[model samples]
Target: MSLDLGMTNAPGSTPRAPGRLGVPVSAAEALRYLTDLGMWLDERRKQLDAIDQAALSAPDQSDREALTHDITVSMALWKAISDRYELLRVTFDSGRVGPVQAEQLSTLIWGRLDVAPGDGREATRARMPSGAESNLAVSLPEACRLSDAMSSSLRARLALETTGLDVSIRVKGIRESVERIRDQVSMMPLGATRDRTQRELIALEQRLFDVTERAKRGADVGGFLGPLEVEVAARERDLIVAASRRHESERDAARARELITALAARGDAIRGLQAQCLAAVTPAPKLAVPDVRALGAVPDDPDAIDALLARLGLVGKALDQAHETYARALGERDELQGLLGALDAQVAGSPAVTAAERADLKPMRDQLAAVLAATPVPLVRARALMAAYQSYVRTVTNNGRAPL
Candidate 1:
């Protein structure tokens, strides 16, 4: 009679139970157990593939040998289990199975199978008689357990190796950063700032040396590496920032020199225009043109240069305002002269007034002309005279009545 055998619900990563040796299990149960083991073997095959790839690509000779050994053993054991499992699966599916087939399947699981010797030269050279150096004979359960243990060991070693590689890469990066920062610091002008920054770089280098030594001695330098990188990066950034600011200051200083020359020339021209405008027109606006000299020479410091630029901007604005004011005053004087000329022509051509009235208007017209023609024309007096002349002409033309 076929007997029922307990199995895991799913062929997952859970450890398989030891096989029941010489136990009577049904054909159906044996098939199910074989199917589960096949699934488990497929998972192990993927893991073995990964280990094989890692072993092949390992740079270190010792690591490669150790990993290769584990990979070889696990793969050989896997092939043996897989080969036996497949045979049992096909035998049961053929529908020709009886007591013999069932016993064979049980024996395959619970019994030992001879794993072939490796094709390596080392194994071949060690070959001996009496099966002393022959292949291993282990049950399916024991094979799976051994493969799991090897996989775990390989993964752990790989993790440690990966960590060491990461630390080494970080150290190299820190060293490169230190060199770059040192170059930047050397380029800085000799001063307390440069000296202080150089001291900081020396300290960082010392700390990095300590970390490298500790790493060489197989100490965990993970905690120190991160902070060292941060400090080095920060110093590099600071040097870059300072260099940029220095360039800006130099540019600003050059700009200030150019502005100084331009502003001085402008001030001279504006002062001359002011004199001419004041002499040509009365009641001209009196605005103080900014003296660019009061700002003095541009400074070397960035902040001082910025301040000087701001002051130069203000001076430029003041010059512009003063120029506008003085030019406008001269313009108004020209406009008033034009208006008076136009009015004088209008009144002279008009026939509404008698010769006696014309003679009466002559003195007032002469006074207005003299005021307008003077070097410093009194605009208030000129306007009053022009208005009086216009009023007289209008009264005479309209004959004491408003024009329609």
Candidate 2:
């Protein structure tokens, strides 16, 4: 005799008692249960179509009602089957469910919870099943589908900042999280804690991936991401800040480019100025400016150019010293003239200077004027005049400070 192990009603009004099948042994066995149910749905769909064909032929109200109710129930069961199988598939991907555990779970959810939804309270309660039912909900495709908004939005936001910032690390994190979710984690023999831990980890990874995609989308994210949610949220915040910084970063880059270009031009200024300044002094054929090769071949990247610019500054300082030397060598006559004129003005205006000190300054001033008047004044004579002027100033200063 056929064993009366269990019974199941048809999708809708067909309340036929059913006999039980043997409990599944492996994950494959569990999959077969879903596959078999899918095949049953196909048959039920045909049954539904046939009922539709009959109603078209005869137009009976009761037949139409039965057809409509059957349609509703068929659609409902199809959705339930799809959802349940997808959950198992997700769980399997995460290394949570092995063969034996999958079979047991198939019995628990499909074989148990998917009973006749006749009573309203029972049907309502079935929709939100607790205890054993909730365990498998996170692995479903709907969970993944629900998270698409965040990932998609985050991807868009990150794309904008790519021109400004190195988002590679974050992008890699997101990609890896997504890949980990898709990858099959280590499938081991069915155990209790291992599955749960793996499940939570994989779920967290998936949730993080979802969180990234959801960034800037502003949609409600649905999943238990655990402590990883903090990471996801932090990453999302980072992406936002990175994106906001992009415009200003680009602007700063443009300014840096201008500065780099200007620094590069300093090479020519340095060479030219060195030549001009060294012309009047000990005329070296070529003054030594340290090789700042990159200045002439400046990089467009601001940070790269900054190092080269610092070298340019050293060259610039040498240029300054060369210019000062040239000024002293070439303008020595003007220098002596200015010293004589200053002394004349100081002697004319001062109360501290005695007549003898003033008379002494006149001869020094006259000597300085004679040196200044000489055309192409010898460099040695110019040097002697400078020393004489400084000595005269010191004497006058001392005489002013001392009692008359």
TM-score top scorer: 1
lDDT of 1 by residue, 106-152 (tens): 77676766566452335533221122244555566655544444444
Clashing pairs in 2: 27-99, 150-213, 150-214, 151-213, 151-214
**Any runs in candidate 1 off by more than 4 Å, and if so which?**
1-165, 348-357, 391-404
Q: TM-scores for all candidates?
A: 0.54, 0.30
lDDT of 1 at 266: 98
Worst 10 residues of 1 by lDDT: 1-10
Measured with C-alpha atoms, the lDDT of residue 275 in candidate 1 is 92
For model 2, the superposed segments whose C-alpha errors exceed 4 Å read 1-223, 241-249, 261-273, 282-293, 296-333, 337-378, 385-404
TM-score of 1: 0.54
Worst 10 residues of 2 by lDDT: 1-10
lDDT of each: 0.68, 0.44
